[model samples]
Target: MVVVAQQTPSGPSPLSVDELVSALELRTSWTLMRVALRSEKLPIGLGWKDLKANASETHSIAMKLRSFLRDYFEESVVTGERYVQIYEIDKALVATIVNACKAVVIPASPFSSKYPLPLNVNLLATAPSDPTLCDVRNHQNGDISFIFCSAGYYDDKNSYEYGQLPTHVQQTYVGIDKLVTVRKNYYQSYDVITLRTALDRLEISVDQPGRLGSLRFEARPMEILSACALHFQSLQGFGACPPENLFPAIAEMYGDHAAGKVVALAFRTMTGSVKRERMTTNDDDLRDERFHHAGMIAVGQDIKPYEIELDMEFTAPGGIAGVKLAGMMSQLASANPTLHGCYIKAHQFIAMEKALNRLMTFI
Candidate 1:
């Protein structure tokens, strides 16, 4: 059950479970949702337009959903050595694993022959333990398959967009989906949560197992953005959609495993606000400090002087990334034009995929 505020023509009002199911259009015909897509059967659930007026943010969500539904996003791809491998895969085992996954998220039921043959797997798994959070199926070809992890999380909180906002360090991180930018005298602190999924546009992998019948599916970012957008809209006091808590990126992201070490080590200064000191420069400052290009550092390396990119690595003795000691980063762009800001990007020691055999399915 969801607890959300809705804005009706008469103002805010309560919404019933049935009303929510209809208004939110929970009933889809196929693919990601559980409902069937037979031509003869009428679609379930009334769309928001049919009910009360939806939140203004809902339109934004709709637009993002439309754009994000692509087969791939370069950011979501776990390039280089950003992946872990699995072993002992067999042709016979594939069916069992596939069937088990379907059962885990979908209930067994009798169906007609006209039932969609080989329906794509898309559904939430909230079993209270290691649940399936975000997934957008791309495609499947024999043993080779792929997917896009719509949900995104950084091991370091400061690397996230909302986390980069100029707010007190004591700001509450809870109810992140409810975060909205308040255009007041000073920027209001917001919870570090979503629609930020698209910001990461995190691309994962579809690895090929050795001499083994191993490989996998397809997915996208649109679904993830749409989900977060709904969650954001719900908090708008217009209509509550999927709450942010449903996303593992905000609800259960951890420094150890869920978020790879690459994401943890990343510190984002270039994209968001770059001011280090909150000391205001102007008297009529709506923002805490002046935003400079100090966060964006694109320079050349030692030998590759011509190679241009956000290549300059900000390094220090202990570590170049992290919120507490981030200021200690002395490595700035030298001989670089954009000297004001520092460069930060997810780094991997190796430049290629490294394989390690494990018994796990999810990474």
Candidate 2:
């Protein structure tokens, strides 16, 4: 039974129980129940036309209906279970209620002869606490596999002229057809000292003997001048030679100059071996001469005589071989020729002087 009330100008007035019961009639359908509230003037026996005429009565009825719906839906039917219903209503007081049932309804079975076969599921467990192991696990799960291949063939005549293949049958050329079937574990470990020590050991194993020696040559002044001329010719493309006036040998070329003026010269070549040795001390300070010398000695061991050839020609005043030869001849004139007696023979002096004079005119 629904009870509705209306407010008057002076006080409150409500619908009697009989009027409320008569006004609302519940009609049931298969899925829901509905109640229609209409105006009292309508032939529908319930005289709600007067209620609608009064704005206050209409509002009162709306409020009462809302409260009644809430209570009816919330009530418990069984000892522990409550029946719930959802309802919708118009602003004019017409309402419909649907029974909300709780049941798990499953659809038709998806397994049939036409459906594709199910794939087997495999589960793998890896150590979650270790980051490396977890990475491996992720790699295993995310790994993808695929196959790709390509083949072709072509033929052409007059291949050389057109830059085409004459009779080339290129078949099954698998450039990168491979499958990564297994995973390999890689562990890398290296220490600066360890690597340096290993390299040092390798150097020591291949270390050869060190050589240290010098070579000296002595010849007549003329022969020396001739050699100088030839050497100068070889280096002509390098740079210009010094003028004749720079050489003292030019003075002896004329008859007016004195004879018996000889020259003595020597060339010394030295070769040293070098080897690498690991440092014994923890101190890496380069400022220490001892430490520096140790490294230098290792480097010195690698020097070979042939590899360290010193060309006096390029080291001369004019950076020309002729200029250097002239300077050597001048030094011979100022210094005592007898000092290098082992290299200077007595018979070679006069011949050397004459040769020196002739060579001077040639320059």
Task: Point to the candidate with the largest TM-score.
Answer: 1
lDDT of 1 by residue, 66-141 (tens): 2221111111222211222112223443444344334322122221110111111221121111111222222222
Tens digits of per-residue lDDT, candidate 2, 1-363, equal 334453222244455433333222110111111221221122122233432233223455545553442222211000001011111123222111001001212122211111111111110121111111000000122211110001111122222222222233222223323322233221110000000111111000000000101111121212222322232232222123221232332222211222221121121112422322222432332223365446546565232110000111111111111111223322433533211110111111122222222333423
Which is the leading candidate under lDDT?
1
Error of 2 at 240 (Å): 43
By summed lDDT, the worst window of 10 consecutive residues in model 2 runs over: 201-210
* Residue 314 error, candidate 1, Å: 33
Candidate 1's TM-score reads 0.19
**Against the true structure, what is every candidate's RMSD?**
21.3, 51.0
Question: TM-score, each model?
Answer: 0.19, 0.10
CA displacement after TM-score superposition, residue 232 of candidate 1 (Å): 34
The residue pairs that clash in candidate 2, if any, are 40-48, 40-49, 222-355, 222-356, 273-300, 273-301, 273-302, 274-301, 274-302
